[model samples]
Structure formats: C-alpha cells, structure tokens
Target: MATEAPQRSQLSLRPLERDGFTARVLRSLTAFIQTADLKPGDRLPTERTLAAQLGVSRSTIREALQTWQAMGVVQIRKGSGTYLARDVRATSLHVPVTINLERQAVLDSLELRRAIETDAARLAARRGRSEDVERMRVALEEMEAAYAEHGFAIRQDRAFHEAMFTASRNPLYLQIFQQVINRISDAFNESRENPFVTEPYADESQPDHRRLYEAVACRDEAGAVAAVTRIIDFVESTLRHDE
Candidate 1:
C-alpha cells in the first residue's frame, strides 16, 4: 500500500479577549498570514471557523475582518472565502521585530530598534505620567514572573518596551517602533537558543533591565539614556555578531 501524505497542521491562534476585540482579531489574522505564508488571493478560513477558533462571535469576526478588508489587508470573496489581498508590505500593520542571524539584516534592524527605543526612553523620562510609570512597573513584574516560570519571556519583555514607548506619548514613535519590534521578535526567537538560552547571557540581562526600570521610574532623562544605551549595547554584542 502507498503511504499517505503527512497532514499539515493548522496554524496556531492566540486567544482573543472581549475588551480588545478588534486589535486581537487583527493580530490573529496577521499571525495566521505569517504562519500560513499567505499571499495575495489566498482564501482564509470561513467566518464560522474563525469565530470558533478565535472564541468570539461571528459578528465580531465579521466586524474585525471587514475593518481589515477596508484597510486592504484582506479581500472578501463573495462565494469562495476571504482572501488576503495583494502585497502587504505597505498596507499591512507592522509589528516590532528582532535581530536575524543574517549579519546585515541583524545590524540594520538593531540600528533601527536602537534609534527608535533610545529616543522613546528619553521622551518617556521627560514627560511620562504616574500611570505610565505604573504600567512599566507592571510590565516588568510580568517579565520577571514569566522568566522564572517559562524558559523565555519575550511577550512580557515586548510589553515592557511597548509600554515605555507608549509612555513617550508620541503616536508616530509608538507605531513605527511596534512594527519593527514585532517582526524582529521572530528572528530573535529563532536565535534565542543560540544567544539567550545560555548561562551568562540570561543572567546578565536582568541587571540591564533593572537599570532601565530604575531610570524610567525616576524619570531621569540622562539615566534613562544611559540605561537604554547599555541595554542596546548588550543586545548587539551578545545576540548580534554583525554589529
């Protein structure tokens, strides 16, 4: 008898909460695209399937999908299915990314991240609110907790940086930085075992985070600058060989 072909696994989906329905749905769809290697004219799963998979109502899925379709991330097909529209580079939502092993790419992304985040820290220190400071603290706590429990803590780390950027209160800064950070995260994860999963690297990162936390908490602009610089330097030296 001929052997059957291996079954392809469905793409994993992140859980969706009611509070941030739109953002959650959009993010999920984007993740699906990334995982499935979706291109223009690719038909996505039906609304019923999406609703069930996302744990949201069909109406909510329709609403979010429609919003993306309008934004040009997706094209709704009358009878076939929803298709991810053409080249998404310009129109699709950008997320923050991490360094890749490719020397040139890693250096380029690192420079962009450093430029964006260093300035964000400066702005946050200069004009952040008590609430913003509190958010940073919470994010830090989440990171520490995740680190102790999970082998890695990218999500919380991402959250902390994002909160810091938000504290800057510069919409443009936050938006662009988020885009780079999210995409870089994939590269970062692919190389995590090489750079981050080991001994000294993991141990050393905490002190850097501590310094950044202190700087932001005190709203010390110079200190924030110095702290962020140190953190970025660590990332470049340890994770990136090209820079």
Candidate 2:
C-alpha cells in the first residue's frame, strides 16, 4: 500500500540560480531548520516536499542535500527519510575552515592535493571494491554529459575525486579532501587556470580520467600512480607556464 506525502511550508527564497547560488540555497535551508526549532535527529521533509515548499525543483533539493550529507549535517536513510545527522551549529564550528587562498596558497594546496591524491590512487588500485569502480564510471559519464552541455563539468569533476577518495578505502583522505575542496575549487575556477578546464588539455583529460579509472579497476598500483602523475603534471605545467 502506498502512503500519501505531507504538505510543507514554503520557504522565503524562490528560483535559485548559479554563481554560488547553491551555497545560498544551503544556507537558506539551514536557516529554515534553525528557525523552525528543528533539532538533531529531527526528520526532514522529503525532496519532493522540500522543493515544493522552497519553490524550487526537486533536483535543487537533492543537490543541496547531497552537499549537506557530505558535510555530515544530514543523513538519508533508504525508505526511512532524512534526518539531521548532527547539530548544525556544532558542525559549523568544528570543521576545519578554508579562507580565500592566494596564488601561492593555491599552488601549495595543489601540491598537497597531488601528494595526497597520488597516494590515494595507489591505495585505491590495491584496495578498491567493485562499487568504487562503478562510482568512478558513473562520475565519468556525468562528466561527459556535462561537457556536452556546458563545455566543462564542475560538480562531476569534484564527484570523480570524491569517488577516488572513497575508492581508496581511506576515510581520512576523503575527510581531509572534502574539507579543502571548497577553497581549492574556488581558487581553480576563479583563476581559470586549471588544465582540466581549458582546451586541448581539457579534451585530453577525458582519456586521462579513463586511464586513471582503468588503472584502479585493474588493481594496477603503478599504473594508477602514473596516471595520477600525468594528470597532475598537466596542471603543474600549465600553472608554471602561466607564471
């Protein structure tokens, strides 16, 4: 037997757009929960219900919730609805924060990303589960689709890295990377200097990502490390050339 969905109150903001608009949406949703006196462990409205209430599409709700889930603020249980995973203000205060990065800071961060990511790739090749391979594949296909539409993929790009971190079977790696992603992506996007986002290299990167996936899929540690190096090398060269 099917149960009926419940009605929800409409949010104040409507019609969210791009350019950090998603961040604003998340903020607004958090505010809604806070003002409503919602507490940790409180169940949230379903996506369809939330979208209707927020005057946005269900996809927007899903995206915001995904980010919130990643941030440890919310949890989605299969057939059990969503719940506030932690107290919002606590997570806000405890997570390591990233401020606006300078050019040198960006480079340093990339170097750190390169270091952590290469090792993570090697570990993924040795330790990856079947689910990990599938996730990388889905993220790759999403990247292709996003490229077909918008010339480059931003969220999919991040998703791929997140998949790799998960595939590595290393929780700390994913935790650390997620903590820095907002600042790192901001620096890369604002500069427009990423090899993966520009032409020639951008086109070349599709196969590179494929190769990285294959290396991990086959449990080829050396191959995975090499593939990661090749990808990061392009970024290092591009950034250096620009300098």
lDDT of 2 by residue, 1-243 (tens): 886433335434455554454465677776667655568899987888767656677877786777678778789889998899877652353233344467677677677778889999999999999999999989988987887777778788779978988999987788777856766676767455664566565676667788999899999999999988988887677666766
lDDT of 2 at 202: 60
Going through the candidates in order, what is the number of backbone clashes in each? 17, 0
Q: With candidate 2 superimposed using the best TM-score fit, by how many Å does residue 105's alpha carbon deviate from the native?
A: 0.5
- What lDDT score goes with residue 46 in model 1? 87
* TM-score per candidate, chains pooled: 0.58, 0.61
Candidate 1 accuracy as TM-score: 0.58
lDDT, candidate 2, at 198: 60
